[model samples]
Target: MASAPQQSLPLFYNDLQPLSSQQHADFKIRSADKAPFLAKQHAVPVTVEEFPLVQRFMPIVFSQGEEPVPLALMGLNEGINTFFDEDGSLNEPNFYVPAYIRRYPYLLARLRPDSDELSLCFDPTTDTVGAFEEGEALFVNGEPSETTKNILQFNEQFEQAGARTGQFMKELKELDLLIDGEVTIQPDGAAQPFVYRGFMMIDENKLNELRGDQLRKIVQNGMLPLIYAHLFSLGLMRDIFGRQLRQGKMPEPQLVQPTA
Candidate 1:
C-alpha cells in the first residue's frame, strides 16, 4: 500500500539543508553506484512527464488519499522491491530508473512557508555530498561549479514536472476518473487469488463513459495517453508478483474467500 510522506521531512530525506558556498564551499558530491535508501521503498512519487517511461517498467497507481499522488510500484507489498537487490543494487542493469530516484539527495524546496521562492537543497545526512576530497566540486572560487549548476538544473526541471503532475491530478479529480484500485493474482494450484488493494487508479469505466467533447478535450490536452499508459501498466502487476515469487520475497499466501 502506498502513502504520501507522513513525517515532517519528505521520503528518503532525513533533513534538508540549503546548499551554500559560505557553509559548504569545499563540499564535493560523490556518485553512488547503489541506492541504499531505496532498498525497501516499494512505491515512489512520479510525475506525469514520466508516465510513458514508467509504464514500461512498473505499474503506475495513485496513492490512497483525498489528494492522491501518482506512484510507481516497485513491488506489490511493502518493503519489497523486485528491481532492487537486498544490497540496494539493481537486479538488472538495463531496467529504466525513475527520474525521482535519479533526483535523490538534491531537490529545490522553499526555505520559508510564505515564500514562493525555492532554493537548492540537499540531504546533509547523505555521504553523497560533503567535504570530501574525491568527487565533483560543488563550488570553485566561491562560485557554483558546473557540477552544481547541472544538479540545480535537474532539480528545477523536476519541480516544473511536479507542478504539471499536480495539474493532471486536479483534472482527473474534477472529472471523477479515479477509483480505488485492486488486483487479484492466482498462482498455479493456489487456493484463492491474492487480492491487492490500498491504491487508487483511473476508473476506466468512467473514462469510457465521458461525453465525446470531454474525451476530445483530454486527448487534445495529452491526458488521454497518460491514462492509457497507466491502464496498460496494470498488467505488469502480475509480472512484478511473479518476480517477487522468483526472488523469494513473496509473503505467505493470504487467501480471501470468493464473494457470492
Candidate 2:
C-alpha cells in the first residue's frame, strides 16, 4: 500500500479550535454562493462512497506517495482546475462537489498528540466562517444548535468514509495491484505525442493473474465494482487532457537535462 501521505493539516486550515460556546456562541457559517477555495486545486480527495457519482464527471485516480488517497482530477496538470473559472467560481453548476470540499472549515482532528482522541474543529481563517451578528448560531444557550449537530453528523460520516478508503487502499496494496501509471496523447497538429507519468494506477495484468479463490473473496467483499470503476474512469484521462489542451491550460512539457 502506498505509504499514507504524510499526515499534515489540510489546506486552508489554520489555528483550529474546538467549537466552544464561550469562544463562538454567536458564530455562524455563512452561506457562500460560490467555491473560490477550490479554484486553484487540480485534485481533491474523495472516498469510495463518492466513487459512483464522481466517476461520471472526473477521472478518479489515486494520489502518488506512501499514503495514497483517491483523487478526483479537475485537470490533467498541476494547479489547473478546469471546473472553476478565472474567478474561482464553478463553471458547471450541476457538477457534484466532493464532500471533502463541502465539509470545509469543519474537520475532525486530534487536539492532543498524547492520546488518540479526535475533536471537531473549525478553521478560523476562512472568510466565510466566524462570529457573526446574525445567521445560524453554532451554540444556543450553551448547547449545540441544530446546524451544529448536522455539521457534526456530516463530519462523522466523512471520517467513516475515510476509514473505508484506507481499507480499500490496503487491499489494493496487499494484492500488489497498483503500479506506475502513464498516458500518451497526441494533439491534432503536434509534432510528437505527449506522455504523462509519475502517477500510480491499478495493474490490470496483475488483477487478471489473481487465483479463483482470491477473485471470489474480492467479489464477496464488494471491492470488484470499485476496482472496475477505477479502471473505467481511466478512459477519461484523454478527455481531461483534451479539455486542458482546448482551454489553453496545458503547461509546457518538462525537459530533462543530460547527465554527465
Candidate 3:
C-alpha cells in the first residue's frame, strides 16, 4: 500500500456554491436568458447499492444570488464507473526470457548470476509506492478485503438513451422551430433566453402517444432514464468558469488526494 495524498480534509458543500454569472451585459452575444435550473432530477427516489441511501433526505437546490449553478443527477453512473486499484497487473519491461535464453546465459550478463541456480531474474515492479489523493479511496460496504468491478448494465443503457435523445431534440428543434439551441428567449428589449428543456416540456403524455412512450417506458422500467433535456435560464455556469479544467463535468469523479 502507498501513502495517502495530502489533500485529505473535511470539505463541506452547501445549497448555494460558486456559480458564474456574466457580470457585463455587453459581452452577451446571444440575447436569451441563460438556462438556469436546479438539477433535482438525479435525486429522484431510487435504489442505490441495494440500499435506500439518497431517499433519506429530500434533495433540493436553488439560486441564492446573482450566480447560477446547475446540479446534475449522478444516479447509477457513480456505481458503474467505479473500479478497483489492484484490478490489473503491471506490464514489466522485458518480463522474462524463455528457457532458450537461459541455456545461453552469457548473452545477458544480468542472467549469468541466476543461471547457476536454475532461476531467472524477471523484474520487480511492486517495489515503488503508489500515490492517491486523500479520502478518495473508500471501502465500499465496509469491506476493504475485496475490490469491485463496475457493472452498470442500466447505466450503459442510460448513457446511450441520453445521447439519442439529445440528437433527436436537436433535429426536432431545427425542423419545428429555428432555435439556435434548446433554450428560447423572451421577445423583450434584452431578448433574454428563457430556460427551455425539450425533454422537460412537450407534455409527457403527448409524446407517450406519439413515440408510443418509448422514453417514458425506459424510466418506468427502473432505469434512471433520461426523461428531460434541461435548457433554462441557467447558462452552463461551469463552462463559463472553466470548472471542467479545475473540477470536472462528469458525476462522481474518482476522489484522489490533491498534492502540492
Candidate 4:
C-alpha cells in the first residue's frame, strides 16, 4: 500500500530537490555559523534514538491530536525558543543538540506517493547550501563525495530512528497510554498560575494499570524507561517558562482550565 501521506516538511525546509549529479554536479554546501533557523521554533520533531540524550535537557512530549510524533519542547509558548539568544546563537555552552536540527537543509523524503523509497533532498533556499565555489562539494567528478556519503549515512540513520519512533508511538496508542497533558505554573509573584495545555503525554494512571503480560512486553521492549524519562522531563516545563520570563518573551495570559 502507498505509505501514509508525508508528514509536513520539518520547519525551515521550503523546497526539496533530489540530490543529483545531472542537476547539482557542482553544487557545494557551505558550512554556516550557528542555527538561526531554529530561533523562531519552540518545538522540533525528535526520534527515539536521541530520546535518551534529548530527554536530559528538553521535555520530550508528544504532539497533540492524531498521529502524535515525539517532540522536544524548546519553549513553553509559541514563537519563543529558550535555547537561543537574541542573535539566534545557542546560549547553552554544552547542551546536546538534537539530530533533527543537526540534519537541517538535507533530508530524506518521498518524491512519489506510490514509491516506498526515500530520496535524498536539500533545501535550495538555505544560502549555506547552493552552487558555490567554496566549501564542501555534494558531488566530486559526478560521484557523491565523502561529505555526501557521510550525510547519506546520517540521514539513513535518521530514517531508521523515525521508523522506531513510529513503532513506539504505535505501542503507546494501542495501550491507550497517551492523554492530554496539562500543567499550571505560578510564576513568581503572579496572582494566578499559568495553565498550559494542548500537548499529549503518557498518563501515569493508565501506565500503572497495565496488566502483568502487557507490562512485561513494554519492559522487554525497553519502553518503560523512556516513559519515565518523558514523565521526568515535564518538570522542565517550569524551567522553560522561567527562561522565557527572564528573556522577556513571556506570553500573554492563557485561559485557565478549571481546577479538579
Q: By TM-score, who's the top model here?
A: 1
RMSD (Cα, Å) for all candidates, in order, is 5.2, 5.5, 23.8, 4.3
Model 1: per-residue Cα lDDT over 54-131, one tens digit each? 999899989877778999888888888889977889887768888888988887887766888888888888978998
Error of 2 at 117 (Å): 2.5
| lDDT per residue (tens digit) for residues 1-260 in model 4 | 22223457667777667788878888888876677777877888888878788888888888876788888888877778899865679998868888888888889888887898988888777888778879899898899999999999999999999899899999999999999888888876888788888788999999999999999999999999889888998888888888888889887756222110
Alpha carbon lDDT of residue 199, candidate 3?
A: 19
Provide the lDDT at 62 for model 2: 81
**lDDT of all predictions:** 0.85, 0.79, 0.24, 0.82
Question: For each candidate, what TM-score against the reference?
Answer: 0.93, 0.91, 0.19, 0.92
Candidate 1 ranges beyond 4 A from true positions: 1-7, 253-260
Root-mean-square deviation of Cα positions for candidate 2 versus the true structure, in angstroms: 5.5
- Ranking of all predicted structures according to TM-score, beginning with the best and ending with the worst: 1, 4, 2, 3
Residue 181 of model 3, lDDT score: 22
**Comparing candidate 1 with candidate 4, which one achieves the higher lDDT?**
1
User: Which pairs clash in model 4?
Assistant: none
The true-structure Cα RMSD of candidate 1 reads: 5.2
Q: For candidate 4, which ten residues in a row score worst on lDDT?
A: 251-260
Tens digits of per-residue lDDT, candidate 3, 1-260, equal 22112233111111111101221111111121111111211212122221122112211112112221112222112221111112222112322211121111111112233453211111111111012232222133433212111112233343344355445445333323222223343323533433322112233343344444554544564322222323221233223123222223333323211111
TM-score of 4: 0.92
lDDT of 3: 0.24
